[model samples]
Target: MKSILRLAAATVCAFTLLALQAVTAQQVQIEGSVNLTPFEARGITLSTLYKVDGEFAGKQGIAVPAPFTLAAPRRDGQQILAQAKPAGGGPIKIYFATDDPQKRIFSSLQIIPFTMKTDDPQKRLEIGDYFAIDLLKKLGENRTTRVNLRRQVTVGGLPAAEVVGNFVNAEGDQLLVRLVAVAKPGSPHGIIGIAVGHPRQGRIKKVEDIYDTSASLAFDTVTFN
Candidate 1:
C-alpha cells in the first residue's frame, strides 16, 4: 500500500510540471516578432531605420512607423519636422499628466543627416550634443545637462552611440530625449534617430520602446556613391 501511494504522488508531480511548461511555452509564443523599416539620405543609404511590429506612415521625405502617427510632414530647411502621435488616439497635447491617456501626448522623432569618418564615443557625444542644441533651438529654448550616454554599441551590427537625458524648456517643462547615432564602416554619411518624449511622469516606459525600436534600425538597401 505504501509503494502504491508513493507512485501516485510521483504521477501528480509529473502532471504539475507539464502544466507549468505549457504556460511558459504560451508566453514565449505571444511575444511578437521584431520588424524594421528602411531610411535613406543624400542618395546614399544609412543604417538608421528600425522598429518593431508597426506600420509606416507619413508622405515624402519623412517616413516612420506607427504608434508614431504623423500629422503631416514638413521640412524646416534641411531638417524634417513631423508632428507624430499614437494611432487610434488624438494629438498628445497634454505635457504633464498622471495616466496613460496623457502619456500619448504629441511627440516628435527628428532625423538629422550628416557625414563623419570615425565612430569614436566622444565624437558621437559631440554630435549628439549638437543635436540637443538644434532641438532646443527649435523649441526656442536652451540649457540641458544630466546627459546619459552609451557607446560602442551596435545597431543592426553597425557601430552606434546612444544618449538619453532630459532638459527644461523655457516654460520649465522637462523633455526627455533618446538619440542614437549609427555609423557604418567606410560610409561617409551616417544618420541619427532622435525620439523626443513628452515631459511627464510616466513617459519613460514609452520612450524606452522607441529607443529599443531604433536600436534595430538599418537601411533595407545600401547604395554607394
Candidate 2:
C-alpha cells in the first residue's frame, strides 16, 4: 500500500508540472515568406505588402496565397483581402492587418511562429560581439576590415553604447568591429556571416580563413541560455 501511494503521488506531481509549464511558456511568432532565406522558421508569411498598401482581392472572407508572391490588390478601403489560409505545412497562420507589426496576436493568423526556446533576458549577446557595416566606405573595392566598423548595437535593434571590436574579412584582412546591433533572441541565422573581397581575390579564399582573421565571435542559437 505504501508503494502504491508513492506512485500516485508521482503521477500527480508530473501532471502539475506540465500544467504549470503550459501556463508559463512564452510563444514567439516568426514572420516572412517560407523561403525568406536564412530564416529557417519561414513558412508562408503573407507580407503586409498587399494589405498595408491599401489593397484587397477576392469576395468576402477568403485568403489567397499562390505562387507565394507579395501581391495584394486593393478594393474599396479594405485592408486584409480575406481570411488567411495554410500554405502547406502546418505551424503558422497568416492574415491581413494594417497595424500588427507592433502588436502580438494569438489566434489563427499567426502566419509564422516559433515557441520561444528560452526567455531568460540575461541570456543574450554581449557588447562588441558582432561587426559594423558601412557599405558606403567599401563600395568602390567592396573591401572593409575590423578597423572600419562604425558602431555597435544590441541584437534587439537597440543602439549599443560603444563602437569597439574587430573581425577579419574573407581576404585575411583584419576588420575593425562595430556591431551593427545585437541579434534578437530567437534568431535562427542572426549571426552576421561576413565575406569581403577585393576585385577578384576569390570571395573568401576559404571559410575557415575568415574566422582566422583577427576578431571576436559570439553566438546564441535556438537554445538560448
Instruction: Using lDDT, give the best candidate's number.
Output: 1
| Candidate models: Cα lDDT each | 0.35, 0.25
What lDDT does model 2 reach?
A: 0.25
Positional deviation of residue 52's Cα in model 1 after best superposition, in angstroms: 17
Clashes of each: 3, 22
Candidates' TM-scores? 0.41, 0.20
Q: Tens digit of lDDT per residue, candidate 2, span 1-225?
A: 334334323311221100001111123222332222222233322323313111222422332221122322221222332223233221223322223333211101211111112233332232213112322223123433234334333432432323333334334444232222233344421223122222122322433333222111111111112
* 88-190: candidate 1 lDDT, tens digit per residue: 1212211111223222333444444444434455564455445434433343233443465544455555556666665565556566665565543554344
Deviation of model 1 at 22, angstroms: 46
The clash number for model 1 is 3
Highest TM-score against the true fold, candidate:
1
TM-score of 2: 0.20
